[model samples]
Target: MIRVRVVTSRRLHVASLSTCTTPDSLLAYGSRILHCPDPHKKVALTFECQNRWKSEALPVYTGSLWGSDEAPGLPARGPRPELLAPKKMPSMKQLQTQASIPVIMLHALAHIELGAIDNYWDTLVRFDPVKFQLPRDFYDDFLTVAGDEARHFQMVDNRLRELGSEYGALPATRALLEHAANTAADLAARIAIVPLVQEARGLDSGDRLVHRMKSMGDKESAKVVEQIVWEERNHVRCGMKWFQHLAKVQKREQDQVAYFQELVLQFFPDGLPGPFDVEARQEANMGTEWYESLESKVAHPSGVKLEKRGDTQSASVAAFAASKKKVILAGSVWPERTSSAAGVRSADIIQVLQERGYQVLCVSPSRLNDHTSKLQEEQGVRCIQADANTDIFQKLLLETMPQLVVFDRFIAEEMYGWQAKKYSPEALRVLDLQDVHFIRRAREFAVKKQGLNFKETLDGEQLDIDPVEKIAIRELASIHRSDLTLYVSDFERDLLVSRFQVPDMNLHRCDFFYPAIDVSKLNSFNDRRHIAFIGSFKHSPNVDAVEWAKKHIMPVYRNLGGDAEVHIYGSYGETKRFVKLNDPKQGFFMKGFAPDAHETLSQYRLSIAPLRFGAGIKGKIADSWFVGTPCVSTSIGAEGMSLDGLQWGGTIADTPDTFASEMLHLYNDEARWDVAHQAGVAACSARYDASRNGDSLMERLERTMVEKRELREKNWMGRILWSENYRATEYMSRYIHAKNDGVNNGVK
Candidate 1:
């Protein structure tokens, strides 16, 4: 025989606090606890709040269950403990001294416990569960946590008094609250920093303190620390549970781990130290994924782990201070991922730099969203709007003092490179020549000059283009000027070294990284429906590919396949040229913008990239293979993106008729399609695995940083080019800026 107690506004257990003291709203109860300065009274209030919530069910507000009247302010206290800012806090490096260690340790525990009490209650009031669409259980869990923290505080304070000291006997630091204040506007961030990081870290602290006490022949004190650690383990579990709930509610379920790691970096760039108690943390549902990435970060520099959490302030500050290596990624306004592969390429570069243990700041002159903003919100990539010609950029340079400055393209270097060199002279200037603009322009010129349809392949294998175009001359000089140049293609890396006489040591082949996507998991050949081509129309290579496809490949493909349609997917499709080509009746459909390219490609049987000439890795072919939908591309289109020996996961044919023929054969045969799909997966694993590329890039960047001065010394031509060209670029930019300023000021 069992009885159930339903929670309601009336009463569950029929025991209640004074009606006036215990408010019906959880929010009002929160205000009282936060404002209460008397530590003992605060503890009393927490126990009362907990009992009242469990017995007389407080109305968890749908909309301030107090009915839209203003919520009450926190009751003002006469005085607060002498709160020390993070910087003013004293270091506790010396763990042992002539003074009683128990009191010192107990005081630290009391401060942490008091903070924990506030952390839970403040979360309840500020981030309304109803407003965030959170479950009512959220308030219940936090109330329980608040009760535990209040009890922990009492226990620690009692221990302190027994040792002839009371709580607030010494100055204390509120770094937790300060860091929490930084994320006051963001609830998810508050949760990440407060409980997931700060409180969970307390578990580590408790373990050390327990060991310390037992070592000092204070078994009784060790028991008290042990009790706190046990309760804290549960408190951390509550945080992890609610955090997962919040992530699902906020639609960050898939990105929870990555976003959690990012927030940790954003709030505390210096890695959080740990000889993390794995058993305790795992019991709390806080896995190694959350803290291990960070553990090897600050204190564990060069892969050696820090064994101790010396004291509260030093461990916290050492882990919180901005001592980590830093890098600045400057390019277009921001990463416009949908606009071109250039955007994707730059985003990947930032990922590798971050993996290298550098805190990245992405800066651009243009305002946000003109190009796509890469949700600097989650990735912890700080995006700042500062132009090259201004004092803002100069100030930023001095403040960041970045160890590495990667100009996204030669053009970005051409824009901000001179300014970076002037200011952060010691910084390694890596030129990410995403593609050699000169080689691309040269191919485009040769095609146009030969009077061929833009997609017609060059007759001979040997490449020919004018070496004297302004873009070529400018790009070549830009290449030599940087410390190390990053190339995406083997052919291009070799081309600069052999043909252009740039040193091979000064160049590196860094390609796009892809985590291997499982082909078996993707839609099978029979499940997929149509033939498609996807690209951003802003790029001429894509526009040329489309024009060539419509004119040559699609006609042959449609003629043979009695029932097949070519769906064109891309950005900038509203251009009248593409708009006029939208003929659905003839099986050529135009999809303006596909928000998810992988999803779009999965619905297609095969993709056609009829690019006659282009530089760098072809993203469309990559996308096709990424989704296990085989692609048909020309040799030029398939350049540098080989899975095995010259294999691009599908077929490579130079001629239009043959390109169409190869795609149809692969589409018709399931066995052939399966092989192609596996090849693509293998290619992605080999070529674009982020772990491989990111680690390699970090190592390369570090080596280049060490060799920067010597490398620059070895290149007399590079020095001459930088001295002459970059300075001239500097003057020209300043002149333009002044002219624009004068025009705005009505000076002319």
Candidate 2:
């Protein structure tokens, strides 16, 4: 046995051991003594005894054998105490180098783990309790895990100090911490995947370090690290348990394993093999099945088929895939359902593409429109309301240079798509046709004289046909010029191919997806009694519909003598006819500008859309169906909606008497209205479910892009010609830039 006195700045303590008796034993015991306060301000290790022991009762002190107690320069207060014993202390630089890795790993791990824990807590706070159904113990478990990580960090740090190094002393790579920061959006993902999946890989390496250090005779260092390995096992186990709990609670099947594998490939696409820890995974309760599944998924992500298009075969699709980095969306009129069908067309495509991957740049003609401005601000989309005809628009296009250029209508044909193609050939150009304007206007004139004639309607409108026809032809030409043309319906595609002579290779069909509506929010009609006409009053066709309805249908409804009100509601209700129609005394109600169409439409008994002429799917019909409001419309009103022969919720009549009688019958009869409403809802759900439409549209876009890429890649001569043209455009742009700079500097 040996006796030793441990001196600190605050007090002196005595140690009596039964087995340690050599000079080396006494020195090793002395090495455990630390100063009263930590040398470094961050953290320190200290030891203290509860009771004091008499020196006479202890074994002989071996201080003189290790080092002289009463040497020169001894303090007057007492004999000099050893700061550190030679047996336990290695060379300072050597110890620091040895401890640097684990200490840095611990500090970084603590930051990452705690951040993940806090993020989970915050997410839980924001999560809708009803939607997620998280348990009470979820948060408690997170806190416990955080506590364990903190303890692990402190323990590893202490071991680091024993090896003559401290935290912040080593230059450690921030790759792990950086990855953790990058994936902060999903904390459960970080905890379950990163620390458990990534950091758990460190376990084997840590074990190897311990074994190697012990073999090198650094037994004290090895013992300290043994504690780290034991604690890390539990820490990783915590991650595994929570991860499994989340999977079970969320009902995530094997698909999540696939998703996790994809995420790993995305983050670590280059694949680094080895340094994987199977033992730690087993200890952490991670099954071999999950690991194997993850491995397979990483090797091959599900549904990751690539289709080549244009020059894409020459360059991998990976090169063209949307980077998670910032995206720039440059276009005109987004999220606005204005009279310009282009506005609606561009908005729909932009919304769909954005959901898939695009960072949208929404360029509108004007910022005065509330719908466009509101969508831009709230949806985090960039909106620029600049004249596409001007240099400013070109400058903006050049500055952003979006990967995809989506054109709504032909108005900006020469300015946006064509000009962008002429300037930035790298951008894939897309054209969206809301409808054929020529056909719409031709039908509008033809319907005025004839009661109902679909083919004969376009016979006598030549001059009116020319301007509209020219625009449509130019727009279609622009579509041909573009890489891809997106049409709202397959019907529209056929019409374009047959009527406008658009090539089949150029056109792709993508149907309109109405805003998602909850069916339960609709008011079920027990007894139908009212007829409603809803549309934006600014639209000429809708305005014409209302005027016709007032003159032809209203009188018949009045004659029937049933209590039924005709309601006209939409934006821009200030027109004189609308103002005159608002007289409640006449059973006509012009409810101006509904805050929400679905909300307002749900209350209506029956919907009447007597559209004189319109191309593409009618919004009034769609809105009515969304709220289970049975709609009565003329044939032109249901144009391109694909509702032909599939009994529309209401009758399609051209004659005033038949239209009026059908509306009256539907309004008066409850059973007829209920059947129609159900049919309409079914039509809406089956046709316009965004999930289905969105998936199909995305697939088509992907296919088109791939096809275009492959085409360019396969045709190297064509690509070279295209590149030469692009370079010429670049030279022109440089000339313009030089001219602008000269003007600004007054060089001219």
Candidate 3:
């Protein structure tokens, strides 16, 4: 129990202290630091301990047989600063609003530094260097870290005093002390938990605190915090270094990641989800492949995957895969139909699969939200919150034995495709392009950087150097690796074929079973009022379009005597910019979070999508058509939804004046509006004709299952990639299961 619980008191003299039985060795000096009740004295003792070790006045011990009391693990304390449980400590949010924020923050930081000093010293005394076959630098590096921790404490304490407060002004938590105590007996585990996990987390938090201080105009305080953060990287590096050294000495070098993974999970399970300071961590040597694997939240959504099944196969498991027709749909996000069009598309695929007699289950590496939880609990489609490269998901694969495995996005395919292959080799793999991600990203970069239009961006050489070009490489590989890939747009399909030379047979255009307008139920052109723009605010294109409409398009429409008031409708529109744009006097209303897309859209005469940059065919345009709302959209917005000779619902306008002109004409002319309204209804029906596209999608999937082997055999690139990708994903997932496999097994 290498624990640290402290209280402030008068500093003690070394000769009077009786805790260190052997008062001359390095272990005795280290133990004496922990026994001191005063933080300043602890800091002073830490430096003295380091100096004594350097001067050969205090030698490292060979064994602890003479004294267990030398490192009693319970550090001494005084009375002023009351110790509290972790839950009782003041939150950062609470501290931020107070005048005493600087005092509380500085004091709290000092508390951590003080604890670090104790923990470093405890490590020095608790482990025998000779018995562990350790070098002198193991003792040296930790002593250096201890001195730094002491200096950090003194620095923070000085800042606190200058703020009209002292170190005991705030209460502190024993969480850090408890962490070290929990792993005290296991040397490797203690090093992994304390330094790698806790110290690395402190480094992450320190970066943010430094930024926060600077933003609040406290640059001096920021400098102090920044200095601590910079120095702390070496502390993290020391942890990584010694953990490797200790593991090698123990003949566990081959399974270092595996052993480290188990220790982290056993102690801290939710994982260190960092808005990670990658640069600092990379410099610290904390950037390793296994860190992410060790930190992954890999349990089943229900948190019951580890539970034992009865001797007889459970009825649920039997029914789960009994039909011999199951499909697994994996994605980066859980489906939320009310939030984004992607959500609706996700729900549509699941519904389509289930209707075709396949048992459907959705797997995603996202947290369960209200919408997704409802879908899982009530919608009869099982949605599991699981990461791809995990044994939990691998076990799920074997249990479900899905005949078809569909990845709704290229990113999902990149994550789960290889794992699915390793576990279920016979499953037909499908990647749904969902309107090429890189297409949108490249257009976005061009628009933001070069102020270029979608057409111009497409023709230019910008994709060659754009960051999204790297994404384009991954996307293309995902397409090539799949037995079949689904595309919502023919334009996107042909573009990939012509540009990347993707095989046409390997791709399928599946509009698939999406809800369309009940033509008989649609509102008439004469019945509707107001102009509108409808899109989920979560989509970058929609947010940009709203801004563009406000700053450029809507003002022109009003000046041109467009009588109809413009209304904006979408989900998740709580953005501050959106709130600022909702000026009723200007006749622009942000009618946010439409529950029923069709019904809400049906009230508008026409919609405007002044989208400057986007990739996918606009779901807003499709929704507009479904509700019989004619929409005048930019070319990028109307792309893939238009035909060569056929009329679009309203018109395509790329410029501000053109958009205003076209919108005004459609709103005023009743006969023209009627024709446009009918075109919209026709487009929705033609594109999403459930019986036609639904059967076609299912038929294509069924056919691919039969031809899976033949299709994969012809795709030599996929075979080559599977070999490379398998190795990468295999070792990652193996980390999660390593403890069960035994520590010495390594990647195997």
Per-residue lDDT of model 1, residues 88-157, tens digit only? 8656644234237777777877888887787777777766445468777888888888888888888778
* Per-model TM values vs. the true structure: 0.55, 0.50, 0.63
Winner on TM-score (2 vs 3):
3
**Evaluation by lDDT, superior candidate among 1 and 2:** 1
Shift in Å, residue 157, candidate 1:
74
RMSD of each: 21.4, 28.2, 15.4
* Model 2 poorest 10 in a row by lDDT: 44-53
Candidate 3: tens digits of C-alpha lDDT, residues 1-748? 2333332342222232464443576766766777788887788877777777887646664233423245656676667578889888768777565535666677788888888888888888777565677687888889888988988888888877777777876677877666557877878988998789878878767756875687678777876786687678889989998999989988999998888887888876655553344435654766435476554333343333354344332454467677768888887666667766767777787777777777777777654445555776666766666655446578778888888889978767766787788788999989987788778777887788677665575442334435666568778888888899998877778788877878899999875355655678877777889888888765678889888888887788889988788888875564344668898887889987678877788888888888887776777888888778899988888778886566898988888889889999999898999899888778878877777787888889888889888888898877776775545545655654463333223322
Clashes of each: 1, 22, 1
The sequence of per-residue lDDT tens digits that candidate 2 reaches over residues 510-583 is: 66576666767778785334677777764668878888888777788778764678888876564334667675
**Residue 257, model 2: Cα distance from true site in angstroms:** 65
Inter-residue clash pairs, candidate 1 = 514-688
Error of 2 at 375 (Å): 3.1
What are the runs in model 3 whose C-alpha is more than 4 Å off?
1-315, 367-369, 458-465, 512-516, 725-727, 735-748
Best-to-worst ranking by TM-score: 3, 1, 2
Which of the two candidates, 1 or 3, achieves a greater lDDT against the reference?
3
Ranking by lDDT: 3, 1, 2
